[model samples]
Target: MSVTASQVHGAVQTLTQSSDTLFLLLGAIMVFLMHAGFAFLEVGTVRHKNQVNALVKILADFGISALAYFFIGYWVAYGANFFADAQTLSQGNGYELVKFFFLLTFAAAIPAIVSGGIAERARFYPVLIATFFTVGLVYPVFEGMIWNGNFGLQAWFESQFGYGFHDFAGSVVVHGVGGWIALVAVLFLGMRKGRIRAGKHTNFAPSNIPFLALGAWILCVGWFGFNVMSAQTLNGISGLVAMNSLMAMVGGIVAALIAGKNDPGFIHNGPLAGLVAVCAGSDLMHPIGALITGAIAGALFVYLFTYLQNRTKIDDVLGVWPLHGVCGAWGGVAAGIFGQTALGGLGGVSITVQLLGTITGIAVALIGALIVYGIIDKMSGLRLSEEDEFNGADLAIHKISSTSED
Candidate 1:
């Protein structure tokens, strides 16, 4: 039977929609797996006595984040909701639903990043409560202002600087916000017991390097989907984004290897720092620019992580502030510097706008974190009791350890 032109066009449109939906679904799944990476990375870094707590926190936070974002965060950011009937929500091959799934992964990452810095010392329920407020309210405000262009912030940037702040995949929106909030939490919790005494610091080696390596690998692999699939449509996907991400990851690894002096922990975390830096400009940066950005991020992470541990009282367990907060801010600014046409980038970016936007994100994060964590600390408390911390969260909270005599 000869098909009518209208019918043929309809079929083609259906095919396109289905393809985009499938693409996004795969991306969402890949990003979802990153939670496992977060879990294992924390598991390996914290003391063996706290392994179970690390795993549990990531999982519980994932659940809490899902509900918070699904119910409140998504609406606040986009002014949309899933309150419609399933049939209505599933139109266009459920593209909106999968989009939520994809973006939800990013939202969930806020708590996951915070989890790393506050690991081993935070109380489970209190941290979970903080996660709900953060994911549901604090994060969405900045996210809306940047990505959704809400509140005319982007328009103001464009009016003054000739371009809105350009963060292709949320370097500041997600990573910077998460990292800075974590810094507040770390500060509120204070140093872990005996972490520092009389200005002398105690070094605690990772409990398991293999697990740490595994977690890093998972995040690395998942990051392609994080960056590439961020296009959110088949036609929008670019090989350039993938290439930039690759070069940045390699640069971070190589730089961290040199800067960190072959420390296994630094080596594993280096690539994450690079990826975080590149996320803002992966689409616009020349691969060479990406490499330099990643290298800077890697060196920055190694140096700052060491500085915070040894020379300061801030006991950030996994260096989220350096890897995510600092590098993420740099990514936002680097996009403007490296994304200029003169520098072999796609251009249409302003360094001034980038700096202002990044500073705004940091301000929101710091203020939100202060209020949320401060209130939670005052109301119900944030840290575990001294005895529980001394005994370790695994035994004290979970009533079990990672391994038992069988």
Candidate 2:
């Protein structure tokens, strides 16, 4: 059979497209597993009384976010915009599937942030409600605007600054958004029982340090996909992102150890700080730059975590604010600094653009989260009664313990 020139070109395009789609699917799967890692990490950090509650809330939040993202969030964030240069959605079955999976992973991540804030005593139903609004409405709108090249900050950045804000992955989009929401939730929920008395902080050590360690490891493993997959290019940029992420993780661990004086909390939280820190500019940074960024972030995590715990009466059960919020902001700014022209920019990008992106992302996340959490607190009541809290959320709400007994 004789093939026409047009026919031959069509076949080549189809093959290339198929290969890209497959790679994206695999990346999405790996990102999804990070949710499990988060659950284990959060459960490990809290007391045994809250173990079942933490695990259950993680599961419920993932489920709720998945649905919300699919039904509303995805469209708002990634749907084809009426006005944009790349005005049309990419054509292919794989494009639709990959887009859905990518956003779904992000949706699952936002609520996971809240898990740490309301840990020991929040009612399951109220937590779920908060998760729905965050994943369904708040997260999607910002993410959609930033990533989708439509009506929000990303578009504004491009028009005003002459270059777009770059977040290779979601250091700001996912972690920053989650962290702000967690902070707001913590503020509204108030401190855990015995956490604050007569304006003094109390000790609330982890019930199982081993669980925390394991969870942190899981997150480290999942982070490869989170960072590398965002490159959207399976070959060149993706490899760079993966390498940068690894270096950052190692650097973060080392920094934490040095700063913490061999403390377990420092070691466990270090990798996470590194991951969050490097995420903003993984695609644009070299291995050495990543190392510096990660190390700084790890040190920052140790300091912020300690400060919040000791100086303030805020009870962030798993230290989500430091791990995600503080580290995330630092990472975004570091991206601006270390992501220099000599590094790995497709072309030279100015530091100003990176800084603007970082600040804009932080402001949007903080304000949006505060508003949502405030409304929810007023309507559903963010915290449980003192009696219910003392009894444990698992027993108070589910009537079952981690052991599945009466």
Candidate 3:
């Protein structure tokens, strides 16, 4: 028997579809594990008395995010849903379903980012409510605007500025939006009780250095899957994306080592800062441009985190504002600069487009978060009572500590 050309083509298509589905499923799994990293990072950063709350909150936020995104966010962003019968939905190797799974991990990250900023002082249920609103509504709106070209915004940008915004892996769409919203929540909740005295902030050392490092390591490793698998198909994978991610991470580590003066916490978080900044341009930038972008982000994080902690009343626990918000915005702009051919890039970006898109993302996040968090604050209260805060969230909310003497 002879093989037909049409049969060969169909077989190839099937193989590609299966491979892509498996690829995305693995990516979703890797990103899911980053939530564990978020938990441990919070556990290591917050005071020992609040460690359990940190862990519990991240896990709970993830759960809320999953429900919200699966039911609401996916549809809001892409105008698609899982309302059909299972057999119908399972076509194309169920690629759309796995794609939803992958993006849900990103949507879920909004709450995880906020979790770090509002740790120890926030009421559990209120934050969960905020998570649902953000993941289901606020996040997907902006996500659709950029990634899905919703609302004709991307078309307008391309027509006006010669290019639309290009965020390869969601520096602005995910990290920036999450980070800025976290800023709102952190400011809304205020500083942890007794963290400030006589107009100066008291520094709280991390509870566990090893755990912090471990968490950073997990995020760093998982980020490859996060950035690379963002292509969504085998045919779109690029070695340049992988290389740029590597260079940017190393640049961030080195810059943080110098700027942070060997602080272990800063050291671990450096790669994350770099990775966050590089995400927008990872597919377009030269390794050198990525390095520069990452280096700047690393230094920026150290300075801003220090300033926010000491010189300002903004008590963003774990510095989510700097790490994700500022760096993510920088990533958006950097993609415009570093993605130009003059800067050793692939050349199809415009700085004006990037800035406009970045600003839009920030505006959406800030306005949406202000409304959601404000309503939640007024209706149900956002923070623990001083007594509960003083007792520590682990004991106050969870009725236990991280550990007990047996």
The numbered model that scores best in lDDT is 1
lDDT of 1 by residue, 1-406 (tens): 8999999999999999999999999999999999999999999999999999999999999999999999999999999999999999999999999999999999999999999999888999999999999999999999999989999999999998789989889899999999999999999999899887676899789999999999999999999999999999998999999999999999999999999999999999999999999999999999999999999999999999999999898989999999999999999999999999999999989999999999999999999999999999999999999999999999989999999968
Q: Which parts of model 2 have CA positions greater than 4 angstroms off?
A: 2-4, 80-91, 197-200, 233-237, 342-347, 404-406
Q: Per-residue alpha-carbon lDDT of model 3 for 1-406, expressed as tens digits?
A: 9999999999999999999999999999999999888888888898999999998898899889999998999999999988899999999999999999999999999999999999889999999999999999999999999999999999999999889999999999999999999999999998887778887789899999988888898899889989999999999999999999999999999999999999999998899999999999999999999999999999999999999988988998899999999999999999999999998999999999999999999999999999999999999999999999989998889899888879
lDDT of 1 at 37: 95
User: Which ranges of candidate 3 are over 4 A from the true structure?
Assistant: none
lDDT of 1 at 17: 99
Q: How does residue 86 of candidate 3 score in lDDT? A: 97
TM-score of each: 0.99, 0.92, 0.99
Candidate 2 differs from the real structure by a C-alpha RMSD in angstroms, to one decimal, of 3.6
How high a TM-score does candidate 2 get? 0.92
lDDT of 2 by residue, 269-331 (tens): 898999998998888887899999999989988888889889886778778888888788778
Superposition error at 285 for model 1 (Å): 0.4
Model 1 spans > 4 angstroms off = 197-199
Lowest lDDT 10-residue stretch of candidate 2: 80-89
Clashes of each: 0, 1, 0
